[model samples]
Target: MATCTVALTAIDSSSRQSLEYSSANQSPESDDEAPRMSLLRKLAVIIQLSGVNFASSAVNGLVVVGLPTITADLKLDPSLAFWPTSVSSLANASTILLAGSVADSIGPRPVNIAGGVVTGAFILAAGACKTGPQLIVMRALQGIGYAMHLVSSVAIVTHTLPRGRPRNFAFSCLGLSQPLGFSFGLVLGGILQDLIGWRAAWYIYGGLTLALSVVAAWALPNFQNEGTFKGTMRNLKVRVDWVGALLASIFMTLLSYLFAIRDPKSIVFICLIAMSLPLFVGWVHRQVKLGKPALIPNALWKDTAFSSICGTVALSFGVTTCMELFASLFFQEVQHLSPLQTGLRIMPSLLVGVALNVTTGLFVHRVPALWIVTVSSIICSVAPLLMAVIKVQSPYWANAFIAQVLAPMSTDVLFTVGLIIISDNFPDNTQALAGAVFNTASQLGQALTLGIMQIVSTLVTKDYSDKILPMARLEGLRASFWTMFGFMMLCTLWGAIGLRNTGRVGLKRD
Candidate 1:
């Protein structure tokens, strides 16, 4: 895995060269008066970035929304069926650094385009798979493509755009991608799966992504020898920790595996902790001592701002992912809503998240990021705690809907603040790695939450029959909320202390 520190060093050196070259040749007045990009061009960039986000997030949403359907259709064990999603996430988390390195060697544009194409191809192939093994294989490939697209897209935004209005607006544009795509995917995936089947849904998603890949290849700018894109591919010296990557992948796989085994609560807990815990600890130690190019750099551990923001992002994602996963189960099993109905109900939260992201983009340069993050964290903590108080007979408006709304509003605000905080702290060159760090943390957080929730939900249901009623299942879900609420509190306190109050203009890179 590529560390943010190494990436930062590369970005800083290139930016310094650009500044020096500009000072030597251009008059200060002329440099200041260089023509600003038009509204149309800016919009074009935003659209492209959003498109990139759309493709990646939509795929994730599809996997999440369609997982149960796939399991039923294939008659596979839920744990076995889950590998398609879990392995894909692992592939994505593990491959980001290699993708970042590729972005540094080549321009971000081609890398983004290539990723889009590969994602399209693999998703289509996944749809065609007839067996679980084939589907898992295809999903793993799709994960690799997702890692490439995300890393390249962020790098392109960081390198190609100027640092003020354009960058902020681009951040807003990129931010719109996940929530909106997820919202749209859930609704559409449900509808499509109902009417045309899940396989057809995958086909449609693949085709749409293919179209975006083509447009991106044509419309996006290429950076070759440019300041942010500066690199000598022929002499690239950074090494990758293949062994560490392998161990990390295995550790994550085994951890998820332990969770999937439906065993006695105490036995499952003991087994997972005894086996996977030590494996992970060993992986971390190996990365620290034996890694040549460490998967994640140790230097980043010392950077307060970077570590805090990464933790914030991880917690935010953990809360959001767990909520979405459990809530869908609640609606289907407890509330008696069909998947289609559940998707429709969830649409508002997704839309609200998009609106908040765009709004955050506009206000990031004006408001203190610390304030936004803190407020969002407070909202997250309060919402779930409120939801936990509701009785089985409580109205949706009084408890469920209010909790749902807060989730998106809180997540959007918190995620945007953390993104800006991390982006500002890392140098432009390392911006891609910074994104990888943030995203990896985000995915890992989600995975951990899922594992934890699986345990909680299973244990709570043991007193009941295997065919647990929805309302009864919800009672178990309330236990998980306590965990999420604790995460929010920790993040809130961390943001309050760690996020710096840079001047309310352009943010300063640490």
Candidate 2:
């Protein structure tokens, strides 16, 4: 809390000239956040924010669970099937940095509601699509809206809630919504795919999103800023680092696109990817020289602890998402289970995620972050290995159910702790950007790991003469699991070394 005050106090008077009349940047734990609220009001706000995450994640589960049917029905090109699952992430990562700046310039409430509306609109549009390309485009648009909501929601929660256990619990609820929603989607998507069709599930989820949007419009806090629309836009033009944002977005977009492809070896592709790094670095340097608002300052990464957090964030997210998807595929494609059975098999992950999230939020203030993350990551690393070595004839109780229970432990823990540490490091006014940086790491991990694991799985599958056989595909999936285990181990090592000095985060300073 003192840290927040110090940062806010450092902003010089001259810099305040362009400040908008918005409540974009408020101190976490400020008494101004209302020292207390009624229980019912708190519930409405948490539900509205957390529900957004649930709806988005549920739809993602639908896509992953129903991929086979969707591909077959839409006559999607085999090469393009991966796009629907991943394109939204690419777009989300690309725009989130900018969205963070926008959220800060304006208020979070409008941004939150607008994002919900756009996300719902696109989800509905996606359901009505008749072609793979159409679905891919619509999902891409959803990413943009989701980015708006996610970044703004972080700002909202940080400013609206009293910091400490209350704030911690609220974030935990937000974290819980994602995996729980995804699991619901898995079961619901499975049931819908079997009983009716995947499209109906999308329709239902999309409608739920719009309803949530209405709630957000009414329930979210409306912070007052100083300037009119014209003044705000003018300030955005001058204060926001568009060049820095563009450079970062371009690099991420290019790299993510390359990852989505099966064979991406063109010299042009390689050169552009290579060039994007140095160019982005140079641009950041330029931003520093000009004393401008950089999207993400280069110096921020110099802190070994912060850098390590970002690295571990990527690996943890990558491994967890990989496990969820591949486990689903292994159940259906390798074990020859029906979609409903596959969804049921993955239910343990959802249950564990819910418990881990709430538990972490409750006790995080009492323990050192280093111990929490490193130990849990070590536990999680074992999950992929369990799946890798399991026999086809093994019962669910033997290793499969245990793996599902363990897969999500570290990720849910890291998300809560990481967000706290990362948010603390940033200026009080840049809370949305803090959220953006954290999420960008998660999205990047998912994009790169999923692509790399996909390639590894494909190559290993092709190593056998009869690659199409379930037995051979099982070997390939096992190879991917092995790859995930390796990454999870890396996450554990990095977290242990990086967060060694990170004492308990989210402690009350009031």
Candidate 3:
């Protein structure tokens, strides 16, 4: 049987070559090469890609508003309620690099379609889950699919659009989709939970995903490497470093576990978490030794601008996600707001984010990304600090509203500028990988920092009863906000000092 299998494989390879030769000899009209795509086609593709991103972001937004409802419905321990969100982020962080590599090795089209279908299936499955564990597992699967979709979608945009105004505009639209989708999901989830149940929110997400999967299959162009199938397969087989992949996965898993685990104060867990640093360092060294087929090439590390941008993204975005999670809890438990009310309250920030992203997308090409990131980071810190100082009876307009407006502006600017920097720095071949790394940093930042903040909050407000007074709970939340403020300020400093000025117009590639 083995002998026959090998023989069949060899025969298939030879047949593929024959087909390639025949196709190569075909007439010139058989392949009408267009140097540039029509503007309409470009817009259509960008819209579709952005739509997919919107779907993913909407799902994340649903989790934000739906989490309290889910916890109540499932009769979950409040401490464990965070698992649903953290699991998804953990899965995405761990698998993103591999997904990017696959997209690069094959093509973005297949990865995008497959990711959407898988995400839809798992999310639908999650809607019917009876236990917290089941829901967490399903969400993790959804995260894997989301990672594939995100990496490929970003790569497609970078690959399709040239590196100037069109690319910048496309990236801005892509960034804008996140806040828009998130806002839509927040409102939709709350409305659905009020009308039907929290489960309905998952159903909606699943249905949309399945529909988008079909649309993507039709709309996405096959920009696979131009070569015989056999040759492409051979290249993929030889270039994929399985050892590096395994090590990286192990490293990411340990790091994620270190952050996501609820009992951060446990001595054993702390030791285990501490061990991951050495493993990570070793993984980097191995990648350096492995050279070409490395999971993360050395060239990426050499790019100081890329490193600075990624660090800034992780810090700033991490704080943003943590703030949203905690703020949702505060609105529901402390202020005793309904899910719908919480969504409505947060709408202004999302709207501001969308508007800012649009404006940035239109004109960011004229400014240095470093300056945008630095100025935004400084302004963004004020929101959390303001939140930390707010009293229970503070006026909404004086405190929450102002903070909300400022928060989104920073997030939008930082995200758009970071994407622009990445898109400009990396070549077409590694665009997917670049997107994956950037997203991984964001996810890990969320997972790790949020975990730390939760621990800090717990420790500071240990005397407060979780089941009792709202004021007690507010104390811990305030502590977390202070921590968030500190981190944001540090990110501001990093941006100011570390990021290089890339000139006034377009990206300055190092």
* Candidate ranking (lDDT, best to worst): 2, 3, 1
Best by lDDT: 2
How many Å off is the CA of 20 in candidate 3?
Answer: 29
Residue pairs in clash, model 1: 1-295, 7-430, 11-429, 333-470, 334-470
- Relative to the true structure, how large is the alpha-carbon lDDT of every model? 0.67, 0.83, 0.74
- lDDT string for model 2 (235-261, tens) is 578767888778788888888888776
Tell me which of candidates 1 and 2 scores higher on lDDT.
2
Tens-place lDDT per residue, model 1, 1-510, is 132233323333434433433423222322221123333443455576677577667766777777778777766665576576666766776677667655654556777888888888998998898877888889889988888888777776666544554456566667778888887778888899888888877887789888888778666664542233224433144434455555555555555455556656647556655675456456656667864455555566677767877777777877887777666766666776777887876676786786788777667778866677777888877766766676666777787787778877556775656666666655555566556666677776666666677777667765555554665577677777777788788878887777765335344232
* Candidate 3 overall lDDT versus native: 0.74
lDDT of 3 by residue, 37-73 (tens): 4434445566667777787788788888989778778
Clashes (N, CA, C under 3 Å) per candidate: 5, 4, 0
| Best first by TM-score, ranked | 2, 3, 1
**Per-residue error (Å), model 1, residue 276:** 12
Cα error, residue 151 of model 3, in Å, equals 1.0
